[model samples]
Target: MNVMAKAEKKISSAFIYFFGSFGGILFGYDIGVMTGALPFLQADWHLENAASLVGWITSAVMFGAIFGGALAGQLSDKFGRRKMILMSAIVFVVFSVLSGVSPDMGEASAYYLIIVRMLLGLAVGAASALVPAYMSEMAPAKARGRLSGLNQTMIVSGMLLSYVVDFLLKDLPGEWAWRLMLGLAAVPALILFLGVLRLPESPRFLLRKGDEAQARKVLSYIRKNPAEIDQELASIKETAKEERQANQKTSWSSLFSGKYRYLVIAGVGVAAFQQFQGANAIFYYIPLIVQKATGQAASSNLMWPIVQGVILVVGSLVYMWIADKFNRRTLLMVGGAVMGLSFILPAVINWMMPNMNPMTIVVFLCIYVAFYSFTWAPLTWVLVGEIFPLAIRGRASGLASSFNWIGSWLVGLIFPIMTASMPQEAVFAIFGIICILGVIFVKTCVPETRGHTLEEIEEQGTNHGRVKASNPEN
Candidate 1:
């Protein structure tokens, strides 16, 4: 009986992690598919003279995400995270196909494609906000960081998958290649939608709705020990009861009140900096950057993103190993410092050795990617997932995610224009400075969340002065 129970427990836990992170795969695939598809579109459509159009095609998804994130957050709070995620998966499938089949109705083709991509972006944005929250609510305190980190790992893996898919499909003649790239996202979306049917709604969310019996039943399936399950249920109940007694409703405006102001700043700041530090620019334009540096055609440049993708995946693995073991602040500061140095050194080298091989910049980019994958990429999601109180988590996380997409939107929108007018080295140097500022922000403001339950973290927020001094579990 004991053996059977243990096996069932392990299988159930694995199921949760797998489907919980699957939303990230769709997110990554849609984001990366564009990187390879854009070149083909430009060629087929004769968009060489339309730099503004090119930027719009890439950034339209992000512009839609800003609204998607905000809307998904409020909806999840009302309907449940699992339902919102399931809905997003359906949206992913519908729009991904729409994006791929956009007819070449002359000048209208670009506009059609942009609209479809924006629709797809809405799904991606919802997943970005909801998945981490779902995972954090389901995870044990000791394993929460690693479980939340799984979302990032899946995100990078999806990106790498897209890069590999793009490489494999690059040889196909004409517009079919790009269409297939955009359309392939549907496979993962369908898988996520199917898989989610077997998963339970978040127990925390269930408790919030005043359904302790259902919440307890869900907890029993996920938790290994009966005593631990009881303890977790009690903790959740206590938190929810306290919130109910306060008799205050959580709304978008509540996020800006004095009580939540600092946390809002911290959450939104970290989320925004994660993008503004310029990682997506590399993911979106690696081929272009390599083309300029190596004088290679788009065909040959396809292989280069795979190399960066591998580095990103490997670095995320390293993060999984260390995430729970170290303080969040420590990891972010170390990653920020190293990442800044990686960007700064290449620019310095370019200035001092103007004749140096352009490949040197790529080398530094790999280093920057390594540290970033391990640190900012995964940790930012982890923090955002665990930081907010349940009362406002959905809305606050959504707003923070919206801020992230907004940053991504600006970067995607302006990167081509900026690179056209300024030296690439100068642009990277600016990102390097942002990385340094990230370090200061993590050190001075971010709280340590290791070994604490989501409820405990929420309680700590009521006394902001003690947040920085909180100790990690041994």
Candidate 2:
């Protein structure tokens, strides 16, 4: 027992876990910072004429992420997840500093911030994909779910921290509050960079690269006994060989035909709809939306975001309890129904009265957020992970992630323009409609993944997707 303690403590699993999931915190912080920074940024840069570019500035990071995720997969496969994450951390820190201090070039300052943000988006994109793989690779099989769930927890917590920071600094004179809010994201990135230096290369990555000796060493540190270490190493060797052989047969074209086509559509569709259901619309613009609705001066309060951030974090915690306990399809459809109703109520009320209390709209939006956090947000990835064939898991997961980010990018870009042209409730009405479509999509397309092993899902989906595709009405 003493020796086992010594072995585990030598590398410190907690230390490894912290840095492994740290990327989520950075990504979350980046996500929330803009909510506070945007109003001040527009004021500081005098971006009145370039209001059209506001969406670009808000969404440029997501746009850059599309390319970042694509490249990170190939690069990480060749290099390593740890190395690529370190590179991403460096990029986050540098671009964050640049974003905070973007020079005032009149309206072009928006363009400058947009460019900086898009570059930073590269890191955000990489983290979204890499963190899960890194955390999963480092964890033992029995604990994989709990450990991987930490990444999601950290993401929402980071967002909450950013909101708190924005609230604390709301009173600072001039644009300094927003600058500090934007720039401080570098703090976590820097810590992640430093902390990751102590992290060993994942044993799975080592074994894949034919470094069996190093892989054995890492397993010793992470596992309890020789039996556990040897068993895991052998399993990894087998899985790695299967992945190599499978990679040879899989390609982008494979996802277009056979059972792969139907599965990919379902997987990618759920991923895309998770974002398109209008979660980020609320996440990124809660404060601004509240102020616009309530006629509350921006300078007077930035508190609504803090409230929503709490709901997101709390809701994520609740998801952890119910994650493996329920049918994912049921939870998602129910969430969609509730979310659609939440948005529709506010939209209808405002359309009829046009003078309803702004707080009432805020309440319905919160309800939308509460359901979204546990259901589609986390379950999309859970279902995606479960539905793919073992050989194609890596590729399919990447594809789904890309679709997710693209959906988020489109929503972020379009929501502001949507609200500007229509009444706020009208915009909510559109999102509500999308939420309803999400429910139908799940009912018709997504498979129930509860109580099924990965092999079972793939085996069933192999013929099922083909039959469903052929019959159409089925």
Candidate 3:
């Protein structure tokens, strides 16, 4: 707590936190870049009428991410969280260039981009799986939410940056604009790769591998009181020993068995709902949505994403501020209700007045995005990082992440088709129902994890015959 000690902690915290969650920026960039790029892509390909191919191209990253998350999760467990992230960043930078050149494939460029994006998605999915677990392990429990929430903050900031880049490049020839938007992600990916090079391995992972000296050394930079560093190490060692003695299996199937089952369900279900609630339909295709609703010109479409992106960035900042101060379940339930209502009211207005101004739909969707930014967008990862037992944290995080991508893939692929066959509001109404169900899932399954250590959460899970007392009985 001395002034110089405080200065050192601040510097160390900044380094670890920024590099630790920097992967989120790459992931968010892909999300926002596509929103703007899609319109320009249509301009070059003249695929304005080919909805299926466009949907496939848009959904490709989420499709690849499904396997990437599951694979990286298990691999990070065996190899180490930091190593997998480094590998993923390298892959992301390389594929980003390949994605930029897809326009060279002539008529087949759409399919080519799809193939490249699926490959690039491996890196995106891996980052999604790795960042949360890495951040969780590095952060102390009392401040874990704020630190881990930094991942979401970085993600939205990336999205906002992509929007600005897309706007800047919009006046370029159609093919070149989209190409640069896709390729520009390489710069940030390279920065992440360099930043991570200086980071020490997770202290917990080091101890598990029997490198106590290195683990203590890394913990020293993170903790001011030498005794506090030793205290956490001893607690971590004790928890690992108890789990080993109790014969808890880290096998993939073990997630569904006995004690780990309930926690896995809660963690993975939240991850799934975060996507299935259908936020990506807006993130991926907002420009097209605005055009169809209001008869807005294609040239004017890129501006809308900036407006929405700003809301998301601001909302994430708000979440970081209140993250440690509020209960997780309270924020999730309230946010979900508002998000569901945002979708429902728009649909209802469209139903009641077929001639309703298209701007009204745009407004409601923005409202949905605003609520999601503060709630499920950030909190889902927070829970995914916290709820799993250490023995299977990596594997479980992978499972949760894969489910998340699966929902995202489905929403991205089908939203265009659904809108073609039905009213936009009608499609959104279905998403509204999904959001409400997500609120109920939070009420039933998730336990409050605030103000508790990972070891304490594990021991509490042990004491309960089924779930913690905080989780209500069925």
Best by lDDT: 3
User: Each model's TM-score, in the order given?
Assistant: 0.89, 0.95, 0.89
Collision count of model 3: 0
Per-residue alpha-carbon lDDT of model 2 for 136-211, expressed as tens digits? 8989977776675677789988998898888888878647977889899999999999988778889999998999
Q: Which candidate's TM-score is highest?
A: 2
Model 1: residues with Cα > 4 Å off, grouped in runs: 1-11, 209-213, 245-259, 389-395, 447-474
RMSD per prediction, one decimal?
4.9, 2.6, 4.3
lDDT per residue as tens, model 1, 55-146: 88998888888888778888998999999999999999999989889898876999998888888888988888888778888988777666
Using lDDT as the measure, name the better of candidate 2 and candidate 3: 3
Order candidates by lDDT, high to low. 3, 2, 1
Better of 2 and 3 by TM-score: 2
Q: Which RMSD does model 3 reach against the true structure?
A: 4.3
In candidate 1, what residue range of length 10 has the lowest lDDT sum?
Answer: 465-474
Better candidate number, 1 or 3, judged by TM-score = 3
Give lDDT tens digits, candidate 3, residues 1-474: 477555534448679888999999998998788998889888888888788988999999999988888888778868999999999999999999999978565668888999999999999988877887788778886666677667888888899989889989989998799899999999999999999987878988898899998788788877778888989999889976865754454577877766677778889999999999999999989988988887786646888889889999999989888887888899999999999999999888877888888889889998998999998998898777778888877567777877889999989999988988888888999999999999999998777777777777766555552554346563
Instruction: Note the Cα lDDT for every prediction shown.
Output: 0.83, 0.84, 0.86
Clashing pairs in 2: none
